[model samples]
Target: MRVALELVKEGRAEACVSAGNTGALMGLAKLLLKPLEGIERPALVTVLPHQHKGKTVVLDLGANVDCDSTMLVQFAVMGAVLAEEVVGDQKSPGGVAQYRGRRNQRPRQYS
Candidate 1:
């Protein structure tokens, strides 16, 4: 855990993944890197298989035991953002004309 945190601190690693001890990892992360702005506490986040053949984002698996409504909402928003920006397919489907042309084609600008 210390080594992972050190790598992150030294810019050698972008992020750290650990399954050793949730409490210890959270404590070390909080003490070393600090929380992001507007985030009171960090929530555990993971991607899980969904029933609809898709993926679902689950949060606060164990990191936070008691979360208020606000915290839950925040987690929801964070999960959504992560899914959209990191996991979701950004390109349009094959049938969509908007994405059928040149790969570098930009979206049409509205006057």
Candidate 2:
């Protein structure tokens, strides 16, 4: 994992995709590639198919066991950008939901 990440860090590779230990991948990515400015912690984002159409951008995926409000907002912004630029979606997703336990069904709004 470190070797793959090192290649990206040295510019020998553009990106490193891993299906290994999530914790180890996140840790090494932070150590080698570093997070972007204003990003408290890098998010592990992926695309998932929407039930009706298009796709959904999901993030965090155990990258951070807990996150403050600011971190949540950052993840939302990053997800939106990836959806727009990468996924080529003009409109944003339906909403951003905060997962807590299993009964929280409300979407989180940041002021």
Candidate 3:
């Protein structure tokens, strides 16, 4: 994990993905990559299968225990960017859309 982070720090890699120890990965990533400007915390986001046979992006599963509205907004923006850039049209098929989850309510989609 350290070596993978080092490669990212050295600009040899665009991103790093790991399935091991979420907390450790988050800590190491924060330490090595640093947060993007205006992004106070880096979110741990992943694409998951939705009931509609589509993919949904979820973030900060364990990286953050509690988040404020601002943090949530930041995560949403980051998720949207990831969906557009990383996931791409080939994977999405329906085009990139941002889905914001509300308390006790279904996710609201925005183009």
Candidate 4:
């Protein structure tokens, strides 16, 4: 992941994508890659597989499961930023980031 991010930093790649454990990946991303200009938490986002490239973005899958309403709003904020990054340019590598937390951590999404 570090190598890939280095490539992006060096302009060898446009973005980084991963499908690893949400908490682990978010932790690693926060450590390796700094947050976007306005992103407080780098967030874990997931893009579901759909026909014709259709999908939904889910952020903060389980990183902060004990989250309050404000935390949920924060997830939406992170998701919006990720969606923009993904939709920014087709040529860009990161299209839409999403989160898939552990089986022991799924929660009801109200948004």
Index of the highest-TM-score prediction: 2
Q: Residue 64's C-alpha lDDT in candidate 3?
A: 77
TM-score of each: 0.62, 0.72, 0.64, 0.52
Give the alpha carbon lDDT tens digit for every residue of 1-111 in model 4.
767766776789977776666566566667777665545566555766546655556666456645545556666666666666774423312222333345455556777
- C-alpha lDDT values of all predictions: 0.67, 0.77, 0.71, 0.59
lDDT minimum window of 10 residues, candidate 1: 92-101
Name the candidate that leads on lDDT. Answer: 2
Q: Give candidate 1 regions above 4 Å deviation.
A: 9-11, 89-111
Model 4, residue 34: distance off in Å is: 2.5
Flag regions of model 2 displaced more than 4 Å.
Answer: 10-14, 101-111
lDDT of 3: 0.71
Give candidate 1's TM-score. Answer: 0.62
Give residue 23's lDDT in candidate 1 (0 to 100): 87
Better of 2 and 4 by lDDT: 2
Candidate 4: which stretches are off by over 4 Å? 14-24, 49-53, 88-111
Better of 3 and 4 by lDDT: 3
What 10-residue stretch in candidate 2 is worst by lDDT? 97-106
Which has the higher TM-score value, candidate number 2 or candidate number 3? 2
